[model samples]
Target: MLVERLERFFQRREEARRRDYFYVTEVAKCPRQIFYAVKGFPRPPLDGQTARRMALGDDVHRRIVNALYSLGLAVAAEVPIPENGLFHGRADAIISLGGENFVVEIKSVHPYQFDQAVAGPRRDHYLQLQLYLHYFDLQRGILLMENKANQELKEFLVERDEKVIQETLDRFRNLHRLIFGEGRLPPIPDKSDWEYDQCRYCPFREFCLRDATEPPQDTLEERDTVPSEGAPEETPPEKEGSGKERPAPRDPPPEDGGMEEILLFDL
Candidate 1:
């Protein structure tokens, strides 16, 4: 009964539809998928497990923010970056530490990902934080990850890099022109993009693949696209009669179970 009630409650979620500005986290994902979001394309509704996990993360995120606020560490909580006509997002907090203020973004992660993050912040998380720092004009940012299973914490420090920020901004700005300004979409998934990994979970898989049937007219060179490296590879079929076939894309995240990290950043 509780499961049914919870499912019904979350089913009413209507916010996932579409928007103009890119969420900070979405910028770090497959550009094609992000395009789908901004264009207001149809996608499968969030599954029950995924919805439940988000609810769990919300509870944990709120409680943690309150605790951090009380500790004198947080100068501000749930701070939204002023959408300077490009990107939109909320930092978990602006935290004071060692005489400096850092834009802080927190996450609820599975143990598997938490272990991977011990080396550094997860790729998508850092990308989001990097934007937070650049747009906020802050000197540094913090990525605080909590393991949902056990409440263990992993923290990463990120310093602002103008080079990275500029590259990212240029990329988003171009997409904004095409998506918003020109009413065009980003290019089809490049072979290196590991679109294979992303297609399964993508809301616009059929839409993308169908459009991809035409001759490739990629606006950005394949080399210009950043390679994401996290998903497991499955060798795809060779393209008909074309010597050039796409390699399995390396960077879109498919959850180990159903805990897609990207969903937390979804609207």
Candidate 2:
């Protein structure tokens, strides 16, 4: 029983590690190619003030949704697309009026996200909104930004660009491949242009970026040694174990070895 538990524990650990690696790789690769890739960026744990603000914004958005519904539009708030691998993205406000549907992405940007959108551009937001648009089969969407100054809401209507949509989809698929192909993370780019002010907030920012300086390594060495997708297993045999009848494999496990049990010390 003890041995079985220990084996299961190790297996779980292996699976978790693989998942973590895949996540990092996908996060690193997706953004440049897919405009909406930014939505996939791992969020930092919010502080008390930020958390409260986010909650309030959510409430405000919900209220705005209610207003939309009252205006006699066939509205759906926080509607989800289940067919897309449980993509938990919620459209802040969805309106189907005059036989046309519109996906509304509401943002409570206090000039930071707003400024970034104005200057650097919010590719992630565009990509995510586009994805939502695609799922709903809608060619039009809106980016609603809340203004604290006027206590009024401003809306930006975005028409679906087939080129942008198709390109973003392609990038997403490639990112999916980079993640699940070998269950490993991609290395950070050296010349990672710190164009986004939000880069300072990224956890991997330390490794991928510096104080307005390019990383020492311009490009990561492509390690051919690393396993590729659908590649044949090249795992080596145990150091001292021999032959076809070699005992199950070892205790505590070797670094490169897999889940196959090898009982080192006989009971």
Candidate 3:
């Protein structure tokens, strides 16, 4: 059984390499529909404590990019990670200069927790960029954010810490494993448990209070999946007069995974 599982895992990994099955599987396994009830809660803006001082919209992220350009960094917008099955993530900017490739995730932080929480969200982004490094074998990543009005960019050393990611992949190898993986959707905190100001901006708040309706489920579950690894070959149809054969469709290369960026200059 162990050998069979190992064989299946390798076969799936090879399929992911040849045809980007990771991307297809991740999209197909997206839990947005499954988590609708939990996601339907309202959270406040990043700077809800200060009236009229909150950072709203894309302006905050744009400013950080401008700062990088001024510093002579070549930025690539909306990089796709096909290996992990993630799509066009607007990487604040990607810099490839001075013989170094830098994938920067832009953010803004709340002033009070600026020092403490700055690295929390970007850790995932850095890990994601590291995955991109694996797919193309690049090195180095940077998490850039607006520190007050300055772009505070910190360089991170990408390491080969495949243990956690391997665990995640292994869990995905079987339906039963994935359904009961560690940290499967943590418990949601109660209203009093949350800060007073942080409850207004949650996308799901209305749903939590039964005050609004949710988007249709069919729309969220419409993603397609890759063909089964080691699928049996099908006999080709005979051509008309020439008796020629048609080619099978080829798969695209895989990309990386999801990213969570830091925003809010105050933090």
Candidate 4:
């Protein structure tokens, strides 16, 4: 029992360390969610389904890299980016194809998402790969995705876009200012009707909403202030029965809502 407890403790410590740094993949998420993370707000624990998917993604990444190496392709796995602590990320694998280097990113998605991706790269995925290419000084990258339903594979080639990279950089720089410089929370993302809406299923949804609903400290203090010195003090009304305090009122039920669940692949 003691050994088991020690192992669990170390596991938690390692997980905390992993979350301390911002990753390039997270840049495309809700800025407020990322802001809460960088500000060290406590996040809800990952549900079993989400945790399992993450593990499966990691296993697939390893298998793909090993297969490339066995086929005599020049491959470098888990290539670090930027070498700067301000931002952190690892490209899945850098492979040499026809004597040209390409940053490789692997993803597992549902059939619907795979269909959409086949037509063209998704916005978030496109931006993420662009950052990788920019940092690695490569002109192109490949997004390799597999359909979780039938194991079908598809790949898309993405060229580096300087405009997208600059926009992404500007956003992160602003996020850093909000978090560490001004000590203010970032604004919530505007609502969208997209299939995979980031805010609808964000883990920090409750935290951000709760902060929004609560009254500010100054307002609360003003409401609780006593009357001026010249004003008369009001007397409390006496109860005829027992003076035991009544229970506080319960909160109204939350509105019923749903969002299209998206599978996140970490490489």
Candidate 5:
């Protein structure tokens, strides 16, 4: 019982640490879930096991980034990847190698995730790194996966796909306008969609299902979006594989050893 209480306390503290901006990871999550989170709807406390797992994951991030900083490869660890003030996310590290820099994204995953993704990086993970590559204006990114049970690691390289970046920007931009600008909640994604597992484990599952305040709008009703305040209209992304040189990798010493970071995109 005492352990359970401790886990609950940690869970609450973690929630309190979450800032108001939609995180970069939001690109890979269901909008309705994001809606429930951003709206501050009440939900049950996460169970002890899940809470412990999450805390452990944060610890792993610290350990890995610290090691990289020591190795002289990491220019910056836990670098913020922000898209205007409305969206925020942190990349694991920015590493300089062979006179070039690449975005590094870390995942502490179950061993099964490794076996399942033997072919290549998972789509969601790729997409998350995609955001990092484009926002950081880097030509390439690396996905680093560490097996939770054994700490075994694998690395995958991804190139910046300007087209995908454009699509995601459009998607997140519209979501921002709908949720904050129009004063409307995001429509529920189709339950049959591949990523619907988020709905199953969602804390607000019952509330989301029972309250159909707005019918599901799969298209996100882009026409209805009013540009959000202080959010800038974005320029077109650079072409893919242009072989252009971006600004060199930032050469910043890792000051703190933890995962806290702050970066913003001007809107």
Candidate 6:
């Protein structure tokens, strides 16, 4: 079983490499995270919990597609978008409804998330569907979300927003300029607190934080000044006034087990 799991994992990774472009879902995430990804920075290995959640989400998607087919609806599964060097994605299914075709994007979320989404589409989820709508030239699409815990279903009808789509495309282009053109990393969207809950779960946390701590190396003089290992440490001169002791460093708090599952279509 372990061998089979490893094989499947590598197969997915290989398939991901073959498509060397960003997904709409990824571009919806923090640009700094995307920059690290595009630069080929190493990320932590996928945990089993995350893997299981992703598998479950895939199963839910398949089941939804099959159910649509059973109802005698025309369903196109895994519809690929036009290949753009900067972005690409596949709609889960396109179903013909009421004599009109509509894109279908499925998401499996926790009960609380489902409740929130029922009120309105989440930012990332809404952006992903809009990209699909723009790419397929469709005006309307459906967002189907299932509550993972209770298997409850909720659907929302989303119309294409040309302005939003254009904004998203512009953002992606700007991000490309920062990362690929200038060879500079984007600042973290939220950095006021290092112990921010989301930062703990971010895949690029180590790389992002490490870069934040180090000074930029824009010149040879600055680069050479960085001490090599075993070099004598320089001590600051003692002050002539009263001295104050520095506080000892404290360890970070334990992270919560909140893993963000990499969805199937994004993968």
In order, the Cα lDDT scores of the candidates are 0.63, 0.44, 0.37, 0.59, 0.61, 0.60
What tens-digit string does per-residue lDDT give for candidate 2 at 174-222? 6556545543343333323222323323333333322222112322232
Candidate 3: segments with Cα more than 4 A from true spot: 1-34, 37-57, 83-88, 117-136, 148-160, 168-267
lDDT of 4 by residue, 1-267 (tens): 686565444342111111334677675566666665544444445444444555666787788789878866637888888676456778988888777888988877666677765456656667778889989999878877777768777777777888879988887887777666676777645435222444445555555665543333433433333222111000111112333213312221121001122322211
Error of 2 at 154 (Å): 1.2
Report residue 59 deviation for candidate 5 (angstroms): 2.1
What is residue 58's positional error in candidate 6, in angstroms?
A: 0.7
Name the regions of candidate 5 deviating beyond 4 angstroms: 1-20, 191-196, 212-267
Greater TM-score among 1 and 4 belongs to 1
lDDT of 1 by residue, 174-246 (tens): 8888877886767754645332355445555655665442212332233233323111111112233333335
lDDT of 6 at 28: 47
Using all chains and alpha carbons, the TM-scores for the candidates as numbered come to 0.76, 0.56, 0.43, 0.70, 0.72, 0.70
TM-score for predicted model 3 compared with the true structure: 0.43
Measured by TM-score, the strongest candidate is 1
Better of 3 and 4 by TM-score: 4
Off by over 4 Å in 2: 1-45, 112-121, 189-195, 204-267
Best by lDDT: 1
In model 6, the worst 10-residue window by lDDT is 229-238
True-vs-predicted CA distance for residue 8, candidate 3, Å: 54
RMSD of each: 9.5, 20.8, 21.2, 15.5, 14.3, 12.6
Ranked by lDDT, the better of candidates 3 and 5 is 5
Candidates ranked by lDDT: 1, 5, 6, 4, 2, 3
**Taking the tens digit of each residue's C-alpha lDDT, what string does model 5 give over 1-267?**
697678666664212111245766656666766665555454455556655676677888899889878877889987876557566777889988777898888877767666565657666678888888888899877777778879887767777889999998888888888877786767655434232244434555554656533323442343243322121100111122323323322221111001112211100
